[model samples]
Target: MRAQGRAPTTDGAASATDTRNALDLAARPLGGFEAATAGFTLFAAPLSRVLDVELSALEAQGRGQIVSSPRVVTADRVKAIVEQGSELPYQAKVGNGVSGVQFRRATLKLEVEPQITPDGRVVLDLDVTKDSIGEPTAAGPAIHTKHVQTRVEVENGGTVAIGGIYEQLNRDDVTRVPLLGKIPVLGALFRHRARRDQRSELVVFITPTVVGTQCETSGAGDAEAGKRGPEAGGAGSTRQPLCQ
Candidate 1:
């Protein structure tokens, strides 16, 4: 089914440390950061679009179609899925905003203005430091952003970038195949491994969506959904939620 809606309207990135180490993102501690980033762009982003073109394309191919309600899970939701390691509910949008487009350059991720959403924003963040064991302890190093429109005049409108999307699907092929999602054992296994792995990787948030990593305001509402905060699905560690 197709549903039409106006884009969130307001939304909107970047730097290099002069060289490779400075400009790298995909090379993060992994189960494969780039793969997950790409997967979200292909599988998740299009699905989140108002038109849901990709899913429609699948239906057009005589593929099975899913009858699901339309809801946009916010960044609050993404944090929950990653932190709590839970399955995202059926909805049009997962997380408060759109997952940004991630580009892979060997190990590092080169973010791009998404072809899907030209007006989308992005943010890069990382904080990998050696722990007592000399192992990298990846922490909250996400580059944060927000936008305020300033007219270049009164006619042409060029918006500035604010933050970025957090992509979780690590592989294009895996999420693309609707058939695999239907398999029982395989699907469960895949989801478990995927969620566990997703929270472990680094992030690149594409803006318009704010990182609501807090416990209180992270979408906590109603009796069924509960808090929907970091407590619901948040960093496994003790870091405070960003949204809060």
Candidate 2:
């Protein structure tokens, strides 16, 4: 931290020291394959270092009644957005656009072998265990699935997983885990770190077909329309992007 008046306050927070330190450690990579767990611990946690975009629609007015929707945004609506909106087979009924048998998404025991770049960027080398013996499936068609890896970056809360998680592993994630994870102020730091990690894991996306309109819409439809009469020459409502 800078001394009092020496530095001006800014809108964004500075990156944490733990993140930088972990990045340095991850970049060098002292040990061999045996260090895999430790490597992940850094990148995905803070003990190690690891790290690793839209569209169109509608019209209105004499200008085609131009439907000028630049983007859609949502916050705190993750429940409806993810779980309820998961692209599953059940939603695609006979006439619901998608067709054929929708195989239920199966949960597999995924083991991630971590990889790190010279610059400390982390990636995952995935392995699947068919059973307790950790046998690989042979003489069979391979499972086509999204590879889940948490690329860690040295940033605010030390190590952060920049991949699909929490969304997959639903829970309140605090930075440090187990034992010393609950040590007062330091624990608070860990909480921040965990949140930062979780923040890093956030899934951002864009598409032309709009969805989950419930978050933004407010007021009555007729009243909203009344405000946008010919004299007004403005859209009755507006949409904002997630970044906002």
lDDT of 1 by residue, 1-244 (tens): 0111111111111212223212222322222333222211211232233234533554465442322222223331122111101121222333567543332111222212111122232222221111111122232122322211110100011111111333232332334245665677666544432322231222222222332332452433432234354565454544333433
Tell me how candidate 2 scores on lDDT: 0.29
Model 1 clash tally?
Answer: 37
**Stretches of candidate 1 exceeding 4 Å from the true structure:** 1-51, 67-70, 73-244
Backbone collision count in every prediction? 37, 12
- Cα TM-score per model: 0.18, 0.19
lDDT of 2 at 209: 17
Task: Indicate the residue-level lDDT of 30 in model 1.
Answer: 27
Per-residue lDDT tens digits of candidate 2, residues 24-82? Answer: 24432233433223223233333322221001111111111211112223222121111
Instruction: State how far residue 219 of model 1 sits from its true place (Å).
Output: 31
lDDT of the candidates, in the order given: 0.26, 0.29
Native-to-model Cα distance after best TM-score fit, residue 197 in candidate 2, in Å: 18
Which candidate tops lDDT?
Answer: 2
